[model samples]
Target: DEVFTGDERWRGLPVPAGDRFAWEPESTYIRRAPYFDGMPKTPEPIADIRAGRVLCLLGDSITTDHISPAGSIRKTSPAGQYLVAHAVQPVDFNSYGSRRGNHEVMVRGTFANVRLKNLLAPGTEGPVTVHLPDGEQMTIYDASVKYLREGVPLIVIAGQEYGSGSSRDWAAKGPRLLGVRAVIAQSYERIHRSNLVGMGILPLQFLANDTPASLGLSGKESFDIVGLADVLAEGFPRGKDVEVKATRPDGSGVRFKANVRIDTPQELQYYRHGGILEYVLRQLRDAGR
Candidate 1:
């Protein structure tokens, strides 16, 4: 039998020569190795949630059923029209619940709810009309895609009781996939808010009596969420204020404050690790030893 000497650091760690062992390799070796060879070398972490640079709000009491409906289709709604236009096979255009795994389908299906009247693209009397950069009338999802393609940051502003329905992971995953970086609402429903955090979507709350309308927020404005990393790091300890800088269409800006939804150290760790899924996977792998 042949024997290969393991690294000196693994001398008595019970690791066999051919088996895996934790070795602190030089930076060059790690960076140039086969597993990481194609990885982008950047000063910042690779899985940072803040990298998406967009924010999209979940409206008040947005149920998982709302995020991705679980019923028959009409063939004329946004999801239906998009599917047909894209040449998707009729049989393949299943319910939103079934297609949640695919970003393409979910992004197209977003904001497709029957009651969802896109304030930006309101069909009738409304507070404002959202104009796509192309000067065309389209659904909010289309506009979101345009913004995402333009590399502009997004943040969703919403009213009270946001995300108030069933516990659906896809509800959170969908927004993250859509390039939403944060969600600032007047209030949050317990499970949905945690789900947002689990999917790496920051959830912030307005102070008492503050709301999207109260702050004169419209879907048209751009927003910047400051002190996000710190808020996540500190687990959003009570009294910590999250500042939001909103840039209006005319280029003027106003600042508002929100309360971070993170309430515990475990949650902070989850956020730091880029959500609960990654955190759980890491734990599983570690325990297998």
Candidate 2:
């Protein structure tokens, strides 16, 4: 084996002490993630998603590209605004994929593909959604912020082949950061479904030829996912049935049973810990103790 020489270009950079990392406090490309912020040694029990609002209603064949943080950051997009607020120039603004380490940018970039159409905002495209009850239309990130302010969990309603594309981690991570608690779709791309579970998002699949159109879900309802509390309390089982109730503005409701997509025991553990990252952290912490 040949002895390797260090690159001369970065030879003079100050190195961090011991095993510590030199985290930049103001770097746009790589900021600390909040996934483990205030993470307890033990994870709290996962709860049933109650009174969750539909963040968007999407049609079939929605790809990971439609959901992931990718492409160039627009000067007017939420991610761009964030960068501008942090004093980054428009000319210097990079692509969302290049800034994935910053949850703030990535979350704002979620569902923001210019070509992505949201049924909630018909005749329009990009990251736009109508916030529930008040029915105010705004950017998805803005609406999510308002929903989060009021402690409302968000869900996505979609048709067949949802998340069908390359396995992009930001596709799940962005939604999780945006407060998306669950996704009810006719189907899912296999890896994306697992990635959703890894991010602590519940992926529920429609049962028996059921579709959002058939269910009369107008994306205007407040939803309640029943049986999860009980199931998760005991122990999460693969393919458990959960009841989803969508209450419309008129107080009428559409109810249906959906199959929980946590398909394996290992995935169950990932969800129980609120995510795989948390599970690994807890394991390492416990092992050291």
The most accurate candidate by lDDT is 2
Badly placed stretches (over 4 Å) of model 1 are 1-59, 74-92, 124-136, 233-238, 284-289
lDDT, residue 256, model 1: 86
Model 1 residue 245 CA deviation (Å) reads: 0.8
Query: What C-alpha lDDT, on a 0 to 100 scale, does residue 198 get in candidate 2?
Result: 100
Can you tell me which runs of candidate 2 are displaced by over 4 Å?
1-11, 233-236
lDDT of 2 by residue, 1-289 (tens): 3245457756766777778667888888888889998887788977788999999899999999999847899999999999999999999987988888888899899999999899999988899999888988899999999999999999999998999988899999999999999999999999999999999999999997799999999999999999997876667567678899999999999999999999988999999899999999899888998
- The C-alpha local distance difference test score for the whole of candidate 1 amounts to 0.60
lDDT of 2 at 289: 84
As a whole number from 0 to 100, the lDDT of residue 161 in candidate 1 is 77
Q: Count the backbone clashes (under 3 Å) in each candidate.
A: 9, 0
